[model samples]
Target: MKLLALVALTMCAFAANSVLNRIGVALQGMDPLDFATIRTGAGAAMLWALVGLRTAPRPVILSPKRIAGAAALATYMIGFSWAYLTLDAGLGALILFGVLQIVVFGWAVFEKGAIPLLRWCGAGVALIGLCVLLWPTGQASIPLGGATAMTVAGIAWAAYTLLGRSEADPLGATASNFLLCLPLVGAVMLWSGAGPMPFAGVLTACVAGAITSGLGYAMWYRALPSLPTTVAGIAQLSVPVIAVAAGVALLGEPLTARLIIAGGLVLGGIAISLAARR
Candidate 1:
């Protein structure tokens, strides 16, 4: 029960990243690239302080895994920040998690060469639910640009997770990942010509980076070892739900019928897919 609660906390932190980015970029009018840069830098600083210089991970960049992990982390950060420019917190999470699971499970099929029929069916249902969310209903439709960016972020995040699942030291690897990406993130912000963000936005970015992103990710990596692939996949299904509820409660985002119905189908389908694993 304690461990479950801990895992749940990690999920909350993940969900909080959406809210924080929304708070910074959407509500506070920070430039998306600037927010990403601040987040990467702040997260790197926090991780360095925690792990210290002598003990920090020095993953060999020559390995295919290292290059892939680094690229995925950068893509996830950049795309995630940019996506919040138009997306509501809940809506963004729905799109992100929906894409994330599809990619992860799709990779599973390739790796194992044998996924169950039930899992495939559930994946199909979830894909349909995602379409329902994306389709232009008379009242609301997800913005194509924001959805595309978040979809990219989601795929990158899944790649990062898969590649890092077997890390010998989750904390150190997280620290290394943050530090490695900090420079590129900063460069991207500079290239965008974003200047002088509001203090509120900076504060939100710092909180997201130092707490939710840096520390929360470390916790997630540590917990990954104890969870089977199917169980971990199922556990992440809670993130969208948590983000939706938080978006409504904290951000005052609407809880529309479209979102409710689509969220249920997407999350429920993914749950079925993961739960059916042998």
Candidate 2:
């Protein structure tokens, strides 16, 4: 029961980050680069505070692995922020997850992992679904720029997750990665512009970074050990659904027919792949 509750909450937190990004970037008019900068800084501060409170080993920020992690994190933060400017929270979440699955399995193939045929078909289905979602209908399909940015974000996130496998202390290393990413993200933000940041936007960025991202990740890591490997993987498939529902309820984003069909295919495909791992 506790595990179920924990997993549910963690999924909500993960979804909330998407919603918050939409709110910050779309509604609040926060510059995407500024939001990313604030988010990275806030997440870094919160995570480092948690690590210190727990008396964890001091994080190593300059290591090659840490630098790589930071680079991936920077890419994810920037691209994710840029994507929300035009993307509905639900659609954005779905795209991010769809591409994340693609990258993960692509890497598996690259490493000569023995992937099942079913998984390959599943990946194909997911690709089809993403295409359908992005298909132009002379209507409200996501803009190409937003979709492309989200795809990049998803790829970076997959890389970050894969890199995490080598970490000795997940929490500490994550904290370090957060810290190490600040400069890179900041530089990108500067390259873009240092324009005005709204108080509300900053608040949303802080909430997303500290609460949804930092604490949420910590809770996920805590629950991950208790979960079956299959469960852990399958459980994440629920995040996009949660984000879609929340986006509709909170942000009044449309629940389009196209989105429903494509979301199902993408999620179903990933679910099929995860199930085959059993």
Candidate 3:
């Protein structure tokens, strides 16, 4: 129970990254792609320093499968960072997680062979809740391009997650993916001419990538084996709510009635789904 609680706290750190990115780009006058590139670069460097060189596990040779996983991670990181330039953190998370859940659920069906009807029904309810949460009021127009970018990011993340599950060592695989992906991300930043990275933005990206995100993943998998599928599923519902509250508190983003109600509905639906499973 304590370990699961700790994992949930670390996951909240992952959730905070969305808000942190918003602070770096939307508020701090930094280019989104540049921010993303620096984030990956810093995270890679940190992993190399912290775990890559000193690990006792036989250094896993990079394979085609691993490279493919890195590619997906790079795409996800870049697209996610870019999306925050125009989208609210909470809204962005809703879209990202919504798509991610669907993609991952599909992957389970196709790759894992079968999924319980209860899991499918839970997914459907979560999907409907996400739609309700994201259903725009007539006040502001949605940025289709930004939304598309986030959806692509979600797809990439699903791929990353699936790849991890197939690996011999999930944490080692994640570290390798992060280290290998920096160069790819760097090349994209150079090709796109994303220049003049802000000091504050770079720092925020680095902290988010290296510390919170890196440790978050380690803690998540550490707890996953101990947690029931239903408990794990419900625990994830805390992510978007954390993102929304973090956005409001850290980014000074407004918490509108629509946002509050919609977030509540999403969280509530997940709660109900978990309860049903129990």
The lDDT for every candidate, in the order shown, is 0.79, 0.78, 0.71
lDDT of 1 by residue, 150-247 (tens): 99999999888787679788877787788778877788878879866999999999999999999998888888777655456556766766676787
Predicted structure 2, TM vs. truth: 0.81
What's the candidate order when arranged by decreasing TM-score?
3, 1, 2
Q: What residue pairs are clashing in model 2? A: none
Q: What does candidate 1 score in Cα RMSD to the true structure?
A: 3.3
**Could you tell me which residue pairs clash in candidate 1?**
none
Candidate 1 vs candidate 3: which has greater TM-score? Answer: 3
lDDT of 3 by residue, 170-212 (tens): 5666677777888888888888887667788888888878876
The best-first sequence of candidates by lDDT reads 1, 2, 3
- Higher TM-score: candidate 2 or 3? 3
Worst 10 residues of 2 by lDDT: 227-236
Q: Model 1's lDDT to the true fold?
A: 0.79
Q: Indicate whether candidate 1 or candidate 3 has the larger lDDT.
A: 1
Question: Which candidate gets the maximum TM-score versus the true structure?
Answer: 3
The candidate maximizing lDDT is 1
